[model samples]
Target: GRLLNALAATGNEKYLEGFGPPAPGYKHAPLNNTNVVRDMVDDETAGILVEPIQGEGGIRATTTQFLKDLRAICDEFGLLLFYDEIHTGFGRTGKMWGYEWSGVKPDVAAIAKGMGGGFPIGAFMATEKAAVGMVPGTHGSTYGGNPLATGVANAVLDELLKPGFIDDVAKKGEYLKGQLEGLVKRHPSVYTEQRGMGFLQGIQCAPAVPAGDMVNRLQSLGMLVPPAGENVVRIFPALIADKAALDEGIDILGKAAQSFEAAKAAE
Candidate 1:
């Protein structure tokens, strides 16, 4: 947690107050800016870690060119490139892996969340060269690689790898994006923009519409959208949801916005 706090640029300071300082040497840079990252790297740097699409940080996505530049920078500096794919793995982003969007593979990747299809399991994968130091005894956990978790993960993969499954996700995601854009246009007083990819989407609230208020309003109306940083409301539907389900969600979201606008007018 401390290390994550150090690596994160926002929304981590409160949790780190009582904890001693986070591990040293980790540096942070603005998202999608390769030049800032290049300037921060030096002889002491060992690796670079990033999320292809930030989940809690308002669902911001890294540009393809920025990812490519990071790959090239890692090669030039002899540093390992790492990806935190916990939120974007297992077809969440309409791809088997989020890094697929950039075509720049990471030397190491941390994956979890959807890997076990609701089962509690997490793992880190590395290339053969990057994993040279991980011998049999070097790393072990009481429940790591247990048969049940691995079995569940394999079954999940089997379903995810089925023909047309990922493509359907992509198609539905585009449809959802278009609907969200329409929602923003219709409710200009409540929402300013929509962001993110695939099932992971965020609706940025207008300055007068607090994300927390919108989340509560949606929940009261039989919906549950979470609040994210920068006054964005996160909307992650189940991967198996069909167009009908998505339409229902969008309808509820629109109603919530309409209610907010009504209240504002009355005020």
Candidate 2:
């Protein structure tokens, strides 16, 4: 628990205030930098934890080479590789796991959110060797394995695993990304670019257009695009959204960007 808090501290100094001293074993490295990661590791290092696709950090996705390098580094140093797949797991990325895209597996992975299908549940899966020390009584939570939650997760999995469901998600993601790219080109004054994959997309607002302003504008247009770090507006659609729904959302997004561009020109 303290370790997780310590890890949080590495993300922001404010996280450590009133939380007492952070545990000393963790280190933070820039995303996609293999050199810094390797340099940071040593005899005291136990593992590396990362989000395959950073959600709150502005929808930044790790490169395939970066993940592969992380795995290689972990293996060379006899350390574990952990993935925080809370956002990118369970078909959000058009794959069962975001790490699947890189073909690099983690020794342990923390997954939740979509897995529960709106139910409250979170879990960590470990490899055989990683789980050796995790026998009964080693670790757990009060509501760790609630039957109702597990049942709901199973029901959700049934739909996600159906033939062509994930493939269709991939197809839809490409379509969404293309449309967003076109939006960026059409309103360069409002949006600089688009980031992310699958249903977890983001449009980065230009410096002249704050992400919060765009989010508010979209919300008023009957669409909800949440703002993320680095002036990004996240466009996470429901997995079940069809082409018509996506087109409608894209149209609304274009409208929002156009409105911002128009307001800027008016000034």
The C-alpha lDDT values of all candidates are 0.89, 0.89
lDDT of model 1, residue 52: 94
Clashes of 2: 0
Residue 29 of model 1: what lDDT?
A: 89
lDDT of model 1, residue 17: 67
Off by over 4 Å in 1: 1-11
Which parts of model 2 are misplaced by more than 4 Å?
A: 1-10, 13-23
| Per-residue alpha-carbon lDDT of candidate 1 for residues 12-56, written as tens digits (9 for 90 to 100) | 566666664565666888899999999999999999988999887
Q: Give per-model TM-scores.
A: 0.95, 0.94
Prediction 2 global C-alpha lDDT: 0.89
